[model samples]
Target: MSWGLAVLQHALRQPGCPLCRLQREAEARYLENLLWENVNDPATREQWAAGLGFCARHAWQLQRLEARRYGDGLGNAILYEDLLQRVIPVLEAMAREPAMDPLPLHRRLAHVLRLPRSGDPEGIPGLQGRARCRVCRLGEETARAYAEWLVEGLGDAEVRARYAASDGLCLPHLRMTLICARTRAPQALADLAGDAVRRLQRLLGALREYIRKHDWNYRHEPMSPEERRSWIRVVAFFVGEGEGDGSLDDRGG
Candidate 1:
């Protein structure tokens, strides 16, 4: 099997949404790789600078991962310090902007008519970077690749059966898969959609059983493990599987 197909198949054997699990693992691996190897690489540093460091989620995630896994913050410190060094000049320029624009309306017009500000700072890059977060881009591209793989892989009866046996793709990934299916693998749409419908039906049954068991009279009845977690699964379906995943914004700022 292709590596991606193997990844999808293996993910299906695990708990929760396969795509979400893959994304989380992918992000961890990426950060670990950076900390273990690339933190000081010139090309890596250039990417960090362009990204202005990670988005809030990943910036903190880096720290958390470092502390929890390696108990060493050296790589994170180096990265943040470098990013800060690059960032200071931008904020300083933005701070200087108000002073440069201090002219009254008539004066500003006159100055504009004369010439552009002589010492305007080179494109004042901001905290709000035009560049997408490196981590976020990796997450997105990673998710997209896996989504396409899932959709196309479903063509195999064995892959389809494996997908059906698992918690299945989360809603966001379902959409991504559908998009991929609509264009590239129209035949697989039914396979994925049918699997989704079946899973949703199962969740609905479990949730209803869970709710019924909450009634005063039925409260004494024991709940199945599935029923107990049904509502949470529903919520996860709508909101995604993890923290900082609410938005599908490409820039992830």
Candidate 2:
């Protein structure tokens, strides 16, 4: 089977957001590749040149990961030292640019809302945006590709069965899948979403039981393992996996 199909199959058996897990794993592999083999690679360096390396979140994540694993953080030093050499001059240049006269807050808001800037209607300066992380861009690309592949192959009995039997897609993916299915297979898509709703209702019942069983009147009752993990799963259901610290090590840098 193709890699995307393999990921779908593997994801079926896993709890939490499969797309999140896939992206997290992809990011981990990317970081490992960068640290072990690509740090000094000419092609990798070229990629970093455009964005001055990763976004702030990934930059810190990389530093923390290196510090956690190797203690030396030499990888971070090697990267950011080079990055700063590139960044500092550009920041200096930007700093040297004369400040524009402040537009009134109402005017700024109006301009942002696409209203005419009155005297300077055509060329009022807009807010400068930060460069996006290349890895993040790739992760989003791959996640959508995977989601689309799953939706397209829903005709296959094995694929449908596997998907139906799993814990169900997280909200973001469920929406994406439903949108993909809206025109092509509306009934099947509705059934899929209904199944997810029923599953969530069942989980909600278990969560209630978990809470009740913990009360003073029911202290002797033993909680099922599924009940015990419901808290974690519930949070993952909303926010996707890897939001919590346990997932930090594997999170996309």
Candidate 3:
């Protein structure tokens, strides 16, 4: 099947956060590709060396995947040992060189390390202009592609039907879709906005019912499956799936 159709099929089957699922899958696929095929590639290693390596979350993600795949830390050691070999000298340089300004923490740190400065144009910042995550670059591309697929899929009858039937997009992706629709498909904006409203209303009703069922007056009433999971769904609606996990954004300033 075409990649778009495959993504649509997966999205339709997923109960919530199709875009999140696509992104997560894309990250996993990219990681796996790196582990199995590109770990030893010179070009890939060059990119990692330049980027100063992955952000904490992605770095740990690689180690976790490596452990699971090989049941040994061999891959992690190989990749990171090389990373350390390249990184040590730069860190030594940071330690040896004095800060440019006594208290320009950000600029001084960048200067000492010889890493790209803030607004360097050559480098993109991580959590807060800290350092760039290579995986984040991959993620942004995948997210944009999936978002475009969502916009384009709106033109197909089956795709629209599937979307209308499925749990609507999460708030973050909903925002993205609305932005895309504004320029790409104005009519879809109304339809999608209406769908989002109805979905939220439905979820609100479920949450209300869930709360009501817990009251002494209605304690005897049994909760439906939807009402039982209303709390989780409501949280996911606001936070975006997987975002609540202790990711770099959550931990970083």
Residue-level lDDT of model 1, residues 126-232, one tens digit each, is: 44344668888888788899998888788899998888788777899888889989977877998888878988999899999999998999999998888877777
Please write out the lDDT profile of model 2 over residues 1-253, one tens digit for every residue: 7778887789776665667767777776777778877888887765665455787666666777787777877777787776666545434544565363424432544444332234333333222113457677766666677777677667678877887777677777677677777888876687667878887998898889889998999989998877876776677677666544563233222
After TM-score superposition, the amount by which residue 66's alpha carbon in candidate 3 deviates from its true location, in angstroms, is: 1.0
Q: Best by lDDT, which number?
A: 1
Model 3 weakest 10-residue run by lDDT: 244-253
Q: What is the TM-score of each candidate against the true structure?
A: 0.80, 0.71, 0.78
RMSD of each: 7.6, 7.4, 6.2
Model 3 residue 8 CA deviation (Å) reads 1.7
- Tens digits of per-residue lDDT, candidate 3, 1-253, equal 4698777667767666778777777887888888888988997776665566777878888888988897877766777787666456544544676463223434544555444455554433221324467787777677778777887787778788889887778898888878888986987888889889999999999999999998999999998888887787877788677543533123221
Which regions of candidate 3 deviate over 4 angstroms? 1-3, 86-114, 117-131, 243-253
Instruction: Give the per-residue Cα lDDT of candidate 3 at 2.
Output: 64
Report the C-alpha displacement of residue 198, candidate 2, in angstroms.
1.7
Could you tell me the lDDT of residue 199 within candidate 2?
78
